[model samples]
Target: MKVIVIATAMFLAGAASVQAADKVTFQMDWLPGGDKAAIFVCLERGFCEDAGLDVSLETGRGSSESLTKLATGSSDIGNADIGALMAARVTENLPVTAVMSYYNQGPHAFFTLRGNGIEKFADVKGKHLVTSPFTSSNVYLPLVLNDNGLTMDDITLTKTDPGALNPMLVTGRTDAVISWITDVTRYTRQVEDAGREMIVLPWADAGLVMYSGTIVASDKFLAERPDVARRFVAALLESVKYMRENPQDAAQAVNDAVPELDHPTAMGSLQDAIGLIFNEVTERDGLGAFEPERLKATWDRVAAAQGLDADALDPESVVNRNFMPEN
Candidate 1:
């Protein structure tokens, strides 16, 4: 896939038709992908504009960088896993708070080849595992390892780039790599084209539950620009709704934003993303409803893994549901 230049005429027409509003900068956790459909959807479907927000969604190198950008005020808003924020708070006391979680369930996982003989979590013991060395992965891997009666010392943990995970596994450099279930859809074609089979070990399967792709803002900005932040979250929830109801349209919207996504891959990715984002939410309390019990549970898990006291902190330490959509 290649980046395409969207016609300036359309943007110009849209700009001409809409009045200028408070501009908000949104930094993504990574480059445009299926997990980021809500951001692109908000832009493509004019949800941000309708909410009186002039949103600029920029690509980030990773969660660490995105969080840094948020903390340093380089961006007004950002998206990342809640665990990422927790680790940051512990490591450096970064005052970032999740406003509303997009994916209530964590999607990150250990991906492997089906025929590679890694059919279960127990098989991960003593295996050569490739993973991001960031705090989020650092905390998650050990938790998973401990859950399976193993520790980090039991496996061969190699520090690798997120993009290099599949190649390392395919070439026998690593047995498995940390990834998101979204990878199955986005990189499936590339993995197949490389003649490799793929299998996903979802975190959900291993009793590892956490929030993924949450919209967060630094405390300073949330206090200074609460109106804009609230509008951003409101638009974000609307975008989530769009992705859930009209997945094909959401896919096309994401393809429009990313441009490198070809038609076939984009369609398949849209379907996969729908499953990733829309699961359980529609049947329950709907999108962007921050569940206090789930938030507390995730916090306790992270605290236990990090050897911190969960009782010392409150839900306010991790989440701020003040901006979530009304039930």
Candidate 2:
């Protein structure tokens, strides 16, 4: 199997020689970093080339922003939170659909410095917490708080800017900050720079289990250029598999493409991110394949967290699995 994968990668690496590539613009959910390594690996390692795709990377502010771009046909495909897609689909009737399951588990978590009072999810009670107002994690904050036997009133919460969340945590301006676990390495380095240790309390550990990052495409992009979408997904899936097996190479790909991003931090971020993509849920459902029960479960959680009517939209309608490689 290993030999077959290597041969396939090698074969794809040489594919750009055979044909004219299809240009596909890939919108990002956030700035380039280690957690975003799969796309970089796909581009840097020539997986996109092998699949006859010319993928262009675009920076985005948040999932909702990216989804808006995708729905409006400003972008072809991109990564966004599936829950955001779910809620957006129900309320706004956005013409965007999730094409692949990238992070099978929720990436929301609380980051706090060691000396601070927060040591566990329950420890957050009576503490002041900060989060970027635009993050999709904010929608589920109440559910997580309620699950830990607390409520929004139990903790003093502040909506800080994304760039300031970590600096404030390291400076002790707030007891903790809500961010995705994918930022673990980047945040850990920052905390170390401030001469303080950091501790992370994952919300999933506190009973918030659901899908998070996923590959979504514009409805028109999928409808008008089905073959191009198929090729991009194939390349992306291969890139994801290769990234998991070679974190160092994956990190290097991110750094080599984005020169300002240091290699060590990128490597650490990729390692932390791999935990989200390849885990117990992935073990049961396989890569890029969304299981029916889990789909229902994710929608149930998203609906409960965002206070949406579950009956308004079918969970399956938000995703289309026809592009998963026919193994």
Candidate 3:
């Protein structure tokens, strides 16, 4: 009787272990794109499954909603922009931490028509521009304009959805749009199909560098499931490496998952976006670990625009390096 009871206890323990490894959810800030290099590759290659994570990828309305979901534990993990996260932390005591930053480039920028005779930033002084209502138009865009001897006063800034941008530009409803470079690439194709052309000015040109698509988790998750977080980051880093090695295949995977992104367009946009991915952090400090200098640069740009003290923000509080893989 004693031997039979011990056998039953061992069986239950094994079952519980398997159940524990069966689930995870990854919320994306947007539908799958080249920007989602690591996460998309991991899903396509089975790295997450092999790591014992049954992952689900859900779309977020935007970064703000994604981080909210993560903070409230509605999702296990999600991508966020460091800039948005910092602003939130200042206003609300957001209970979230960035485990890794995927895009070294923040992916925000201005776009223009090729034949507008406006090759230089100075020409934007009197142009019509499109931007999202929620983002840093009043804050960050001014810095770019000021840097070029222009300001919001210099141009007509139009608030529009990304879907409306292409039509607005093509129809002359707006002169240009401030948007993601990938989105610019999509618009580029639409314009080309309509016998027009566009130019992409990366955020790097204006000195407002930031990390986009950071992996974030709830504070509760960090405290309760450290091991699982570590595994997720490790698998993500592996996915990044895989995507870099197989850019064409990775692009195809993204196209397959996001059917709205037709094949040729997806391939071109992926090729354009690959340049924005920074391998520097992964090669030097390892993935997901916090870097103070980069954080400081981000804050400095924000301070220039918002008149906030750069030193007032605590970089360490927003980033947690404990879960990153040790080299």
Candidate 4:
């Protein structure tokens, strides 16, 4: 009887530990893809579980929609663009704050064939450009043009469905397409099949320095579950580090979670996107560090694009770095 009681107590303790794993809903700012491999890798490869978290994933259409979800408590924490968060803070005082910088540079870029007349930003003048109507990239288009010594008047712009932008560019229907570098492989594949090489003129290289995909959370989540939030951030950064070291397994994790996605395709996406996370800026500032000057510059551009007052946001108020773990 004494031996039986001991075994039963041990079993009950084991069950309790299992139940104690914190449940977290990680909202995705977009659908599952190579760029989104970080969250999926963490969940599928057991990083979140290792951190004592029972994480569930959710998909979103865009940063604006994801911000709405976070603001209303429909979700807890997710990846979003810092510029979107800044705009939201100005338009609506949402409680969401970015905790860690993910992509330290903006992914916005113009893709075209190298043989095309639009090899440089200055070359975009008097060329036909295509872009999707709903993308946040549209808001910053004017600023990119201004930096290149051009304006909306210089280019004949077409707003179309996202699916059609690349086709237009590759088929020579348009001279260039404004898109994100995250889709480099996808666009490359399409352009290659068309017997042309896809050339990406990234806005970051052309002077649009700002923070993109960042870890954002509702204020309530931070206040109510500080430990879980901290653990999640640590696990997320760990996943990114893992991705850098093991690109194959990291990309495979995405297909493991969403089997509809092809493995090689996802791998291509991961290869193109990994640089956005672990580049010169990351090396200089360290992972997830948002320098004061860059943060201010981000707000300045966001304000100019959205026509919001620069003083509308302090630039520092939209972020809370307390959730980031110490080295």
Candidate 5:
């Protein structure tokens, strides 16, 4: 009888432990690709499991779309552009907050083929540019143009499906296409395959600095499961560190998870992604840290572009720094 009772207690304890694992649905801002290698690495390496999480990945139509999913509680967390999150907060009054910034330097940029005569930001004037309406780049184009001494009147803007932007540019239907700089490796390969040379004009270079990819959660989720959010961030940063330290293995892990991804392209994309993840700020403040001044600058610029009152929208309300891990 004593042995049976001990066995039953052990079984019940194991069952409770299994039931305690948090179910976290992580929505991606785009399709599963090389850009999301770090998240994939975390999932593949059992880091999330070790952190007491049962995390799942969902493909998102775009960054704004992902934010919508988080706002509606469809996803527990999401990786999205900070600009889009700000726009959503101002326009829809969503209670979503970003916790960790993965892309300290925003990836928004314009891609043009060499010899297109659009060598500088000023050259974009009087040229044809294609972009998707949902892209963060298009959403922030006004600010980018204004900062560079230009405006929408200076360029002919064409709206198209995200898939069509690259094709339209490569086929001469447009002079350039706006996209994320992280897509450089993939798009450059495509252009080279078509016998064309690709040139990227980064928004950061033109003084349109902002955070790009970040981990965000709805207010309800954070309020209810703060521990889970912290664990998720910790596991994610661990995966990022592992990825940075072991590029080749990390790339392989990504390719293994998403078999359709080309190994070499995955490696190159991860390398570029890492470059965006770390900088002097991240070095000094630690990874996943946000400088209040930098956040305020980005928020002000985004709010101004959207014609919203920057002072009314407190940056701290949009971002909660309490969730980041110490190391």
Candidate 6:
């Protein structure tokens, strides 16, 4: 009789423990690819499970769409551009906040053929530029041009589908295409296949410095499940550290998670992604840490571009550092 009672109590406790694992629906800022290997690494390695989270990932179309899902509470957490999130907050009064910054330097860039005679920023004048309406780079295009003594009037802007940008550029339909630097491998391969050499001009080099690829959560989620949020952040940071140490293995993990992803392309993308993930700022402050001054600068740029008052919204209101893991 005593043994039976003990066994029953143990079984109940085990069931309760299983039930207590928090379910986290994570949404990416864009389609799944090599750039998203860290999330897959954490999921496949059981890091999220170890942290008491049962996490799932969903592909997103763009930062604005991802932020919209988060703001509407349709998704628990998302990876998006901090600038886009700030714009949404200012423009729409969304109740979402960025908890972790993975990309200290934004990946936004403009790519063109080396033979296009566009060796410098000034060379872009009167050139036809192709970009998707929803790309983060497009959001900052005005600011990037203005900082370089140019404006929208100086260039020909062609809004097209994201898939068409690469094809249009390779076929000589456009002079340049704006996209994230992580896609350099994809774009480079296409340009090379078309017998052209690609030249990349990152926004950071053009003086449009900002944060990209941030982990965000809706205000409701943070307010109600702060513990789960911290655990998720810790697991994510752990995966990031793991990827930094073993990039090849991280790439393999992503390929394993998404079989359709090409290994070589994924590896190339991961290599480019690592450059943006860890920088002098990340080394000094720690992973996922955001400098207040940097955040303020980003806010100012976004406000200037979007025609919003910089003082209308506080940076602290958009960023919540409480969920970052303790080093």
Prediction-by-prediction clash tally: 0, 0, 0, 0, 0, 0
Q: Write one digit per residue (lDDT tens) for candidate 5, span 1-327.
A: 999999999999999998998999999988876678888888888788899998888998887788888988999887988877887887889989999988888788899999899888779999999988866677689988989899999999999888888888888999999988777888888899899999999888898876778889988899999999999999999998898888888888888888888789888788767778877767866788778888888898788877888776787778998899764
Clashing pairs in 2: none
Q: Model 1: residues >4 Å from true position, as ranges? A: 1-20, 90-93, 194-196, 261-271
Question: Residue 236's C-alpha lDDT in candidate 4?
Answer: 94
The TM-scores of all predictions, comma-separated, are 0.83, 0.91, 0.86, 0.97, 0.90, 0.92
lDDT of 4 by residue, 1-327 (tens): 999999999999999989999998888988999888889889999999999999988899999889999989988999999999999998989899999999999889999998888777789988888999988899999998898888999999999999999888877899999998888999899899988987899998998988888999989999999999999999999999998899999889999989999898899989988878889999899999888999999999999999999888999998888888887
In order, candidate lDDTs are 0.76, 0.91, 0.75, 0.90, 0.86, 0.87
Q: List model 2 lDDT by residue over 1-327, tens digit each.
A: 999999999888767455478889999998999999999999999999889888899999889899999999889999999999999999999999999999988899999998788878999999999999878788899988888899999999999788999998988889999998888988998899888999999888898878889999999999999999999999999999999988899999999999999999888888888988998888888998889888888999889987888898799999999877887
- lDDT tens readout by residue for model 3, 1-327: 999999999999978867877467888877777667567778778788678877888888788898899888888888877777877777787998888776666677777788865676677778888887776544678787777777679888778775787788778777777777666567877888878888777666666665655788888888887888888888988887777788787777777777786656666666666666655654664455556877777767766666766776776678888788877
Candidates 1 and 3, the one with greater lDDT: 1
Please give the TM-score that candidate 3 achieves against the real structure: 0.86
Q: What is the lDDT of candidate 5?
A: 0.86
- What is model 2's C-alpha RMSD? 6.2
How high is the lDDT of residue 176 in model 1?
83
Question: Which runs of model 2 end up more than 4 angstroms from their true locations?
Answer: 1-19
State the lDDT of candidate 6 residue by residue for 247-296, as single tens digits: 88888888888889878878889988987888887887678888888888
Best by TM-score: 4
Pairs that clash in candidate 4 = none
lDDT winner between candidates 5 and 6? 6
The alpha-carbon deviation from the true structure for residue 240 of candidate 1, after best TM-score superposition, in angstroms, is: 1.1
Q: Judge candidate 5 at residue 168 and give its lDDT.
A: 86
